[model samples]
Target: MTDTTQPNTATDARPPAAPRRRRRGGAKTSPDARVAPPPQPGARPPRKPSPVLERLFALYPRLFGARFVPLKLGVYEDLLARHPEDFSPEELKLAMGQHARSTRYLESVAAGHPRHDLDGNAVAPVAPEHVHHAILELHRRRHPRTPADAQAGLNARLVARVARAIEASGLPHHDYAARVRSRDASANAVVDEALITLAAQAAKREALLRAFEASGRGEPEFAEMYGIPLDEVRRSLQQARAARTPAT
Candidate 1:
């Protein structure tokens, strides 16, 4: 203390901490600090549609046009398969458009109708008899020797007969312009024949129900196998029973 060494006081203080070490090379930069160019104003992104939506859109035009008849028929078949209830007038119109009336006629013929006679007794329409007879004749000519051939032939004949009768009665060509205009009367003839054939098939089912009842069998175990309703089957069965009973 007595030597008074002028103690390096003011200039030394650790050299200002070496200016924070200058970050080794320079101050660190963040990725966001870099500027990016902006996109052009008019550029648009491509539009895409789902595959299912695209398929439905593609089908719309055909589905709404006259060509939709086959589609409607397919839907009818599906409805008959899944649910045996008859389609309402509005539903038929929506599905068949111009052909609604014809479709309804066919359905009625296939299902048969009940009318009241003079004394207020119910009179049932005879199911497509002519058509059934014609089918039997055809099968007799074609498959004369098959096993259980008579019964099978009878059933086939009945189916065809019903289909033919309905076709003739309904006159489906009245609604189909192409059929009406075709030079081949044979086409219309064939269509009429077909209606009877279908009606006969329905009648054959009724006949089967009768066979079951005559044999003391319970209501047909598989009456609704074709997707027809159990109640409708029962109704047909009742009709068959009444027809067989002969009025007192």
Candidate 2:
């Protein structure tokens, strides 16, 4: 009865709270919201370790550990099915991509390691083309500082690399040529030169073998007559014999 005659001064002294203003679209703006500036053109994105990669390392230490191995083709499907609860398809795909492009993985491929599955079982051999490309990429990475004037030496190294890969493949000239054709004209030219060098080497070895067989002289005598090192003659003969032997 005492307050009914007059306004409650405590409530009247307090101002009402301000209403939140809405935008043109009726969406309320947040005071703490911020807009990030757009990324600069030609700027590289920052690199950081991915969370999925860490999880992969925890699960498959053998493949994703300090020592990496070449993974079998289509390993993405296996990973997706095996770890459905832990990872999404997109996350796993990106993680696998990062792993494959890593230097250690490329090294394994270049070294001609057999492709391995999740269980570390060798499923199939790495293709010759894959090995060739890996070697080329690794070479570029390792020789990033090579000067333009040293191009001849660089090309020689490239030819050597291609030749080594071709030899390791154990494929005939025509077969390797057919399998390794690509849009890279310079690489193709290098491969052509490497093949020619290999053919020349084979011809020389065959001639040496024929000469040794015709001379009927022992290893030392034949080497002395041809002015070649006995070890070299022996190696050449051994290689020729292996080449002639039909694969069983």
Candidate 3:
């Protein structure tokens, strides 16, 4: 008899496989995922400020702000001690170097301001030699196009700055010269000129003091006799006395 069972010609009885659900987060990414497009040609990427500097700014805005102040000599140690976890020694050193060498910091140093701590408290006076160097460096930065020969001759402004720095130091002329002497003959020549200027000023002040003492005149009388302002005469006398006083 012909079997009633029809040949099972129907397609496989299993239901169609479910479409793969997309990953919850999206398509799977590979290790070689595409990165952001590179910066356009000739277009520079914005530079991010050093992380260490950012941390320092957060901690001591006053010390690291636009109007920077001279930092105490041991500020590096102080920072490390206070924020051991926030900074690595090498990066901290690099940031500090950059900060110290910045034009703003040099300006603060050149202005004869006292060094300050993180708390903004004045800690000590910046050394006169440091001030002198800052002034020179600032001049060099500003006058990059100045001829080396002309620079060697030393400009009037630089000469005056040198004189002021050494005079403010309250050090003997020889001592000051010895401290700042370098192999640069031009710099030495400038220093010599400054010494001469300081010497003349010293002599004038000494003579004025002597005359005032001999005349037994009060500051006002002495100022009148010399046709100088009373404040000027007093300031000159005080400065001379301070110069004579030994540094502790």
Best by TM-score: 2
Better of 1 and 3 by TM-score: 3
Candidate 3 per-residue lDDT, tens place, 109-222, comes to 998999998789998999877887898789879866445556656678888989989877877779889988888776788899998888888788888888888998788887
RMSD in angstroms between candidate 3 and the native structure over all alpha carbons: 16.0
In the order shown, what is each candidate's alpha-carbon RMSD? 21.7, 16.3, 16.0
lDDT of 2 at 206: 91
TM-score between candidate 3 and the true structure: 0.69
TM-score of 2: 0.72
For candidate 1, what is the TM-score? 0.23
lDDT of each: 0.45, 0.86, 0.85
**How high is the lDDT of residue 192 in model 2?**
91
Candidate 3 — which residues are off by over 4 angstroms? 1-48, 145-152, 210-218, 238-248
Superposition error at 123 for model 1 (Å): 26
Q: Tens digit of lDDT per residue, candidate 1, span 1-248?
A: 36556545676544655555567766787988756656578966544533332332344433322322123224445444443454443554354443323333233333443332222244454334322333333444554554554333334444444444445544342342233333544334544555555556557767767566666644545454445576777777775565456446
Evaluated at residue 198, the lDDT of candidate 3 is: 82
